[model samples]
Target: MPVLVFIDQSEGQVKKASLEALTYGAKLAEQLGTHAEGVLLGKVTEDPSLLGKYGVKKIHHVDHDELTHLDSQVYTKVIAEVATSMGAKLIIFSNNADGKTIAPRLSVKLKAALVTGAIALPETGDGFMVRKNVFSGKAFANISLKTDIKIIALNPNAYKIVSGEGTAEVVSFAAQIESPKVKVTQTDKITGSVPLSEAERVVSAGRGLKGPENWGMIEELAEELNAALACSRPVADTNWRPHHEHVGQTGLAIAPNLYIAIGISGAIQHLAGVNRSKVIVVINKDAEAPFFKAADYGIVGDAFEIVPKLTAAIKNKKANG
Candidate 1:
C-alpha cells in the first residue's frame, strides 16, 4: 500500500508544516518500500505537481468551491474515502490546527491507530513504533501501533523539509463534497509581522520588560532579526501585549529555529511551549533565572542595555554585508 499524505494549504498557499509532513511521509514510504502520494483539497494557486519536489510521486487533487474552507467532518469523510480507495495503509498529516481537527476524526472513522505530535519517523524494524513528545514537551515517548492502518500527525517544525527534483503527476479526484457545518462570516488577519506559529525565528519578552512602553526595544530587535514577536502570559493578561502574542503552556506552542527570550523569567509553564526550539537565547539581568538553564546561550545583563546593543550589532552586520 502507498503512503498517503494530506496536503494542508491556507489561502491557496501551501503551509510549511504540510511540506514537512510531505517530506516525512515520503521518507516513510521509502522505508516501507512503497510510493508516496499526496491528497490536496480546495483550489490552490500553485501547481500541485510542484509538490513532487518534496518526494511524492503523485497528487490527487479535489478542486471544489465547498472545499475552500476547513470543515473537519467533511474533510474526514473525503480523506477516509480516498484512503480506502487508494489502499493507503499509512496516512500522514501535519499536526497543525486543520490536521488536529481532521486526523482524529478520520482515525475514529477508519479505525486506524492514530499518533499525534510525532517528532521522528517510525522505527519499523520490529513493529510500527513512533516517537512523540508527551506532557507539554517535557519528555519523549515511543508508541507502538498494532493495526493494519496507521495514522500519524507530524508535529510542526519537528521534522526537516527535504526537497529534491521531480514533478508529481497530478490526478483530479472526484470526491463527494459536503457543505461545511460551520460558517466563517469574516476573518481578521494580523498583518505586517511574521506569524509566530510558522516563524523561523521568534523574539519574546515578559513582565521584566517593566511595562508596555518598553516594548519598542523588543520590537526593534525582532524587526532587526525579522522574527515574530511574542510575550509571556502575564504580559498578555496585563494588556501589555495582545493575547495572541502569548506563548506558554496555556497559550500558543511554537518550535522555531531560533527563539530569543528577553527579560522573561522562563517559568516552567512558559518553557513548555518553546522548549522544542533548535536554539534558545535567553537575555535576563537575573543570572539565576530558570530560563538560562534551558537556553543554548545566556546573556546576564539588563534588557535595556543588552537589547539595544544586540539590535545595533545585527543592524551593523546587515549593513556591512
Candidate 2:
C-alpha cells in the first residue's frame, strides 16, 4: 500500500511543516518498500510536481475553491476519500493546528490508529512503534500501533527534510467535496514579522528588557540574525509586545532551530513552549537565572550592553564573509 501525505497550504503557498511531512512520509514509504504520494486539496501557486524533489513519487491534486479555507469536517471527508481511492494504508500529517484537528477525526472515521507529536521515524521492527514527546517536552514515550490503517502527525522541527533531484507526476483527483459550514467572513494576518510557528530562529525577550521603549536593541539583534521576534507571557500581558509574539505554555508554542531568550526568567510555562528548540541561548544579568540551565549557551550580561555587541559581531562576520 502507498503512503499518503497531506500537503498543507495557506494562501496558495505550501507551509514548511508540510514539506517536512512530505520528506518524512517519503522516507517512511522507502522503508515500507512502497512509494510516497502527496494529496493537496486547495489550489496551489507552485507546481505540485516539484514535490518530487522531496521524494514524493506522485501528487494527487483537487483544485477546488471550497478547500481554500480549512473546514475540518469537509477536509476530513475529502482526505478520507483520497486515502480510500489511493489504497493508502499510512497517512502522514504535520502536527500543526490543522493536523491536530483533522487526524483524530479521520482516524475515527477510518478506524485507524492515530499518533500525534511523533518525534522520530517509526521502529517497524518492534510492531510499528513511534517515539513522541511527553510531559510537555520534559520526557519521551514510545507508542505502538496495532491497526490496519495508521496515521501519524509529526512534530514540527522533529524530522530532517531530505530532498533529491526528481519530479513527481501530478495527477488530478476527483473528490466528492462538500460545501463548508464554516465561512471565513474576514481574515486578519500578522504583518511585518515572521510567523512564529514556522520560524527557524527566534529572539525573545521578557520583563528584564524593562519596557517597550527598550525593544530597539532586541529588534535589531533579531533583524541581524534574520530571526523572528518573540516574547514571554509577561511581556504580552503587560502590552510590551503583541500577544501573537508571545511564546509560552499559555501562548504560542514554538520549536525553532535556534531560540535566543534575552532578559526572560525561564519559568516552567515558558520552557514548556520553547524547550523543543534545537539550540537555546539565554542572556540574563542574573547569574542564577533558571533559563541558564536549559540554554545550550548562556551569557551573563545586561541585554542593553550585550545586544548591540552581538548584532555588531554578526554584521562583521557577514561583511568578512
Candidate 3:
C-alpha cells in the first residue's frame, strides 16, 4: 500500500501548505518502507514533475476541467475514488480551508480513520496513533486510528518542507467527472501583497496604530523582513486595512513561523488563530497588554518609536553582511 497526499491548489497553482503535506507524506512513506504519491483534482499550470523533489514518486492527476472550482461533495468522491483505487493505506491533507471542509466527509465516505489538526507524524508501534491539538491549543491528545485506511489533516507550518534532488513521474488517473452541484456566479479576489496564509513570517498591527497613515511604519518593518502584512479584526472593521489582511477568529487563521504583532492587545479570539505560530513577538507600549503573555518575545514601547529602530536594525544587518 502507498501513501497519497492531496495537493491543494488555487488559481491553477499549488498552495504552500501542499508542499508541507508532500514532505510529511514522503517522510511517512519512508518510515513505512513504502513510497509517497500525490493526487491533484484539476489542471495545474505548473509542472507536476517538479514536485518529485519533495518525495512524491508519482502524481495522480484527474485533470477534469469541471474541478476548476472546489466542491466538497464532488472533490470528496473523486479523492475517495483515487485513494481506494491506489489502495492507499495512509492519506494526507493540509488542515487548511479545503481540508477542513472535506476531511470529515471523506472519513465517512471511505470508512477511513481520520485525524484533523495533526501536529506530528503518526506513531505506529502498536497501532496508528496521531497527535493533535485540543482545548483550543491548550493541550494535546494522541488519537489511535483503528481503520485499515488512515487519513491525516496536518496543521499548516507544523512541519518543515524539505526538498531534495528528485522529480515525481506524472501519471493520468481516469475517474468519472461530475459537474459541481454548487454554482459560482462571481468571484471577489483580494488584491496586492503576499497572502498571509502562504507567508512564512508575518507582521500584524492593530487599532493601537491609530490611523491608516501611521501603518507605513509597520509595513516598512514587514518589507524589511520580507514578511506578509496582517491586521487585527478592529483594524479591518474600521477599514484601516483591507479585510484580507485580518487575522483572528473571525478572519483568516495563520501559522507562520514567526508572527510579529504590533499595537495589538491580544484577545482570546485573536490568539486562537495565531497561537499555532512557532514564534510570536508582541510589541505594545502597555506593559500589561494581554498579548505579551502569549508572546515568545515582547517589547514594551510605542510603535512609532520602536518600529523604525527595528527596521533600521534589520536593514543595517543586511548592509553589513
Candidate 4:
C-alpha cells in the first residue's frame, strides 16, 4: 500500500506546511518500500504535477467547488472513502488548522490509529512508532501505532522540504462532494504582512513596549527583517494590538526559523507557543526576565535602544552588499 498525503491549500495555492508534509510522507513511503501519493481537494490554480518535486508519484485531485471551503465532516468522509478504496495503509496530513480539524474525524471514520504533532519520521525497526511533541513543545513522546492503517499529522516546519526533478501524474478522483455546514459570510484578510504561521522570521513584543504608540519600532524592525509581527496575550487583551497578532498557549502556535522577542516577559504560557523556534533572540531591559532563560541569545538592555541599533546595522549591511 502506498503512503497517502493530504495536500492542504488556501486560495488555490498549496500551503507551505503541506509541502513539508509531502516531503515527510514521501520519505516515509520510501522507508516503507512503497510509493508516496497525494490527495488534493478543491480547485487549485497551481499544477498538481509540480508537487512531484516533493516526492509524491501521483496526485489524486477532487476538483469540486464545494471543497474550496473546508468542511471538516465532508473532508473526513471523502478522505476516508478514498483511503478505503485505495487501500492506503498510512496517511499523512500537515498539522495545521485544517489538518487538526480533519485528521481526528478521518481517524474515527477509518478506524485508524491517529498521531498528531509528529516532529520526526517513524521508527519502523520493531513496529510503527512515531515521535511527537507533548506538553506544548516542552517534551517528546514516542507513540506506538498497532493498527493496520495509521494516520500521522506532521507538525508545521518540523520537516525540511526536499524537492527534486520530477513530475507527478495527476488523476481525477470522483468523490461524493457534500455541502459544507459552516458558512463563511465574510473574510477579513490581512494583506501585505507575512502570515505568522508560515513566516520564516518573526519580530514580537509585549506590554514592555508600554502602549500601542510604541509599536512603530517593532513594526520597523519586522519590516526591515521582512518578518511577521506578533504580540503577547496581554497586549491583545488590552486592545493594544489585534487579537490575531497574539501568540501564546491559548492563541496561535508558531515555529519560525528566527524569533526575536522584545520587552516580553516570556511567561510559560507564551513560551509554549514559540519555544519550537530554531533560534530565539530576546531583548529586554530587565535582566531577570524569564524569557532570557529560554532565549538562544539574550540582550540585557532596553529594546528601545537595542532595536534601532540592530535595525540600522541590518540596513547598513544590506545597503553595502
Candidate 5:
C-alpha cells in the first residue's frame, strides 16, 4: 500500500499548496509504514530531484507541454490511470482550485472515497476518517471513507510543511499523456507584496478606505511588516483592488499567523473567509462592527491616523536594528 500525491503546478512551477500536500503525504506514509511518491503531471521548472527532501521516494513525471495547462476532464482521466497503474491505495490532493475540479472527477472515475477541504490528517486506526472544516471554517466534520481507495484534498495552510534529514531517489515513470481540451489563451497573474496563502502575516482593507488612493497606508504598513496585502469583497468587486486580493467566503480564504484589518466593517461573508487567521486585529471607527467579535484585538479609531503611527513604529524598530 503506497501513497501517491498529485503535485499541483502552474506555469511550469509547483504551487506552495503542493508542498503542503507532499508534507502531508509523507507523514501519512510514515504513519502507515509505506512509501510516499509524487506525480507531476507537467514539466516543473524546479528540479524534481530536490523534492526528495519532502520524502517522495520517486516522482512520476509526464512532461508534456499540454499538461502545463489544466484540463479537468483529461487530467482526471490520466491521474486516475496513474493511480490505478501504481496501485495507489491513497491519493492526496491540495484543496486549491485545481484540486476542487480534479479530485471529485477522479473520485467518481476511480470509484474511490474522497474527502475535500481536509483540515487534519486522517485517522487510520479502525477506518479512514478525516477531520475537515465546515460552515466556512466555523465548524468541523469528521468524514469516514469506505472504499478500497481513499482520496483527500487538503485545505491550504491547515497543515505545516515539515521536512526531515534525508533525500530520496527520484524515479521517472513513463505514461501516455494526453493534450487537454482547454487551451491556454492567456493568464492574468496576481502579484502580492507577500505570497498570500503562504504569508505568516496579512494586512487587509475594505471599502472603508474610501478609494484606491487611500490604499497607500495599508501598503506601507504591510510592506514594513513584510505581510501580504489583502482586501474584502467589495474592494475587489468595485475595482478598488484585483479579485485575487479578495479574502472572504466568496474569494480566497486565508489562515495567516497574523491578520490585520483596517477600515473595513466585517460582514459575515467576509469573516467566513479569514476566520482561520491565528490572530485577528480589527481596526474600525465603529466599535460595534461585527468583525470585532471575531477579532482577537480591536481598536476603535480612524485608520488614517492609526496606520501611519503603526508604520512609523515598525520602521523605527527596523532602523534601530
Candidate 6:
C-alpha cells in the first residue's frame, strides 16, 4: 500500500506545512518499499502534478467547490474514503490546526493508531517507533504504533523539505461530497502580512516597546528581514498588536527558521510556542531576561536604540548587494 499525504491548501494555494508533509511522507514511503502519493480535496489553483518535485509519485485530486473552505468533518470523511479506496497503510499530515482536527477523526473512523507532532522519521529497525515532542516542547518521546493502518501528523518545521526531480502523475478521484456543517459568514484577511505560522523568519516584540505608537521600528525590522510580525501575549492583550500576531502558549505557536524577539522577556509560556524555532535571537535591556536562556543569540540592549540600527544595517547591506 502507498503512503498518502494530505495536501492542505488555503485560498487555492498549497500551504508550506503540506509541502513538508509531502516530503516527509515520500521519504517514509521510500523506506517502506512503497510509493508516496498525495490526496487533495479542494478547488486548488496550483496543479497538483507540480508537487512531484517533493518526491510524491502520484496525486489524487478531488476538485470540489465545497472543499474550498475547511470543514473538519467533511474533510475527514473524504480523506478516509480516499485512504480506503487507495489501500493506504500509512497517512501523513502536518500537525497544523487542520491536521490536529482531521487526523484524530480519521483515526477514529479507520481504527488506525495516530501519532501527532512527530519530529523525526520512524525507527523501522525495531518497530514503527516515531519520535515526537512532549510536555509542550520540553522533552522528547518515542511512540510505537502497532496498527495495520498508521497515521502521522508531523510538526511544522520539524523536518526538512527535500526536493528533487520528477513530476507527479495527477489522478482524479471522484468522492461523495457532503454539505459542511459549519458556515463561514465572513472572511477577514490581514492584508500584506505573512501568516505567522508559515513564515520562514519572524520579528516579534513585547511590552518593552512602550506602546503601539513605537511599533514602526519593529515593523521596519520585520519588513527588512522579509519576516512575519509577531508579539508577545501581553502586547496583544494590551492592543499593541493584533491577537493573531501573538505568539505564546495561549496564542499562535510558530517555528520559523529565524525568530527575533525584541523587548520581550520570554516567559516559559511564551517559549512553549517559539522554542521550536531553528535559531532564536533575543534582544532585551535586562541581562537576566528569562528569554536569553532559550535564545541561541542574545543581545542586552534597549529595543528603541537597537532596532533602528539593526534595520538600517540590513537595508544598507541589501542596497549594496
| lDDT, candidates in the order shown | 0.94, 0.93, 0.91, 0.93, 0.89, 0.92
lDDT score, candidate 6, position 177: 87
lDDT of 5: 0.89
Q: Evaluate residue 274 in candidate 2 and report its C-alpha lDDT on the 0 to 100 scale.
A: 94
Clashes of 5: 0
Model 1 lDDT, residue 50, Cα: 95
- Between the candidate structures 5 and 6, which one is better when assessed by lDDT? 6
TM-score order, best first, reads 2, 1, 4, 6, 3, 5
> Which runs of model 4 end up more than 4 angstroms from their true locations?
none
The C-alpha stretches of model 2 lying farther than 4 A from their native spots are none
Q: Which of candidates 4 and 5 reaches a greater lDDT?
A: 4
lDDT of 2 by residue, 191-277 (tens): 777788988899999999999999999999999888999999999998989999999888988889999999999999999999999
Model 6: per-residue lDDT, tens digit, 1-321?
A: 999999999888899999999999999998999999999988788778999999999999989988988898899989999999989999999999889989999999999999999998899887899999887788899999999999999999888898899999998899888999977678787889888888999999999999899999898999999999999999999887889999989998788999999999999999998988999999999999999999999889888889999999999999997
Worst 10 residues of 4 by lDDT: 180-189
Model 3 alpha-carbon drift over 4 Å, by segment: none
The segments of candidate 6 whose C-alpha lies over 4 angstroms from its true place after superposition are none
Q: Native-vs-model 3 lDDT?
A: 0.91
Q: What is the lDDT of residue 110 in candidate 1?
A: 92
Q: lDDT of model 2 at residue 142?
A: 95
Worst 10 residues of 5 by lDDT: 165-174
Q: Which candidate should be chosen as best, given lDDT against the real structure?
A: 1
Q: Write the per-residue lDDT of candidate 4 for residues 231-271, one digit (tens) a residue.
A: 99999999999999988899888899999999999999999
lDDT of 3 by residue, 106-162 (tens): 999989889999998899878889999886676799999999988999998889999
- Residue pairs in clash, model 2: none
Deviation of model 3 at 10, angstroms: 1.4
